[model samples]
Target: MSEPTPQTPGTARDDRLAGKVAIVTGGGQGVGRGISLGLAESGAAVLLVGRTLHKLESVAEEIRAAGGTAECLAVDIITDGAPEAIIAAAVERLGGVDILVNNANMAMPLPLSDYPDDAFRTAFEGGPRVTFSLMKLARPELAKRGGGTIINLVTSAAVRWDAANYGVYSAVKEAIRALTRAAAYEWAAEGTRALNVAPHAHSPGLDWWMENNPEEAAAFVAGIPAGRVGDPLVDVGRPVAWLCSAEASYLSGATIPLDGGQSRWG
Candidate 1:
């Protein structure tokens, strides 16, 4: 286990979550898409939740094309009862829950004072609130499965940098990280597991940034240790699969950083 190498096979879709059902919030695009597909690759019945029905459908089709079972749920995860609806859909369609990836986060970067209350609410909807609500819903269901995994996908930049303007969003995500650890400790005896995957990969957020500022995007990539952005299937994909797999059975409540060593320099 200490061998500095992955025990699983390469990038081909594997059956790690063979009998599992997973719900991925904001599964339409970006980091959420990466994690959703990863779980599907592991053979989990994926529930892709997002505001964009078309995008969610596209992802679902891809999963089906790959011969994996998937379904699309379109709704703002921040909406009241959205999480509950998602959980219900999984139960009705796939039977039960085995894993959950909280991948929905409003990435509206703004100063603390300038950040509107509604924006803060939107951000919190995905950051900590959704996580809390989902866990509350999944707790009882996980017991029936004998155990399960709840993964929170936070951002590494929030912890490693001092972005004065980004503090509001960071605070919400940091709360999720804290919750991840707390849940890990409290749910240990209940056969429940939780963890945070803080990724600094080139996701839809980065693409938005680059599209707005080509210079800044180029500079950012140039500064990376690997001198390149992360690949969802290879970089972000593998770690997510591992965490959702039995191979990482002993891990829980870990705040893992998969940022191509971005946090290492600091």
Candidate 2:
């Protein structure tokens, strides 16, 4: 055999993830879509999992059109056995997973006294519950790979008290932060990195919020430092790319705020 070929620095970029895969929950829309595409643009095959097949397929189509590898799976992650089905499907299709983006969040932002019991139940069931399940499912795969990244998509409300109107949503997201820190202690030794990304609301989700409650839209828009709402790709996507990349290899159990200085509001 010829002498072993010397590897060049740049030539190995694609293979940086040749055998790796990523599963992005709620990747059909909003920040999750941004994360999924960002990860794929970096050379990893991605599984976009969410409740809406149409949205998932749209994101998947974009990824494929852009020459990236992606597949869509629609699963109601809040149902008793749904998380298991979603994770199992991704694991089967991808063979093994190297990254997990816990962006699937459900929330009902209502005042304490006016909060709907069903809404609270949904948020509790969907947010922290699903995060826990996905992490548990991804653990062995991450261990097999010897290194992996888990970024939990969080909202700024989890950090700032008096955040406009998200009481119950913030609580579960806070629980998610605590959950990630707890997991960091358990899995850091296994070459796993768990982190939280607190991003300001941006994307079609915001649009829906605005449409549903247009009266609050202007007030919300006025507070942003950018003087306008941010774009999910540029605002939310790039930061997620960094957090998921080897650039963040040294970070674990960390919470990063991508809030455009809005977190400065008291």
Question: What are the candidates' C-alpha RMSDs?
Answer: 4.7, 8.8
The prediction achieving the highest TM-score against the true structure is: 1
Q: How well is each residue in 92-130 modelled by candidate 2, as lDDT tens digits?
A: 887778888888878867788887888888898889988
lDDT of 1 at 85: 93
Instruction: Determine which window of 10 residues in candidate 1 has minimal summed lDDT.
Output: 1-10
Clashes of 2: 0
lDDT of 1 by residue, 81-191 (tens): 888998898888889888888888875668778988888877777678888998889888887898798899876658555687778767888899889999899987888
What are the clashing pairs of model 2? Answer: none
Each candidate structure's TM-score, on Cα atoms with residue i matched to residue i, is 0.91, 0.87
lDDT of each: 0.79, 0.77
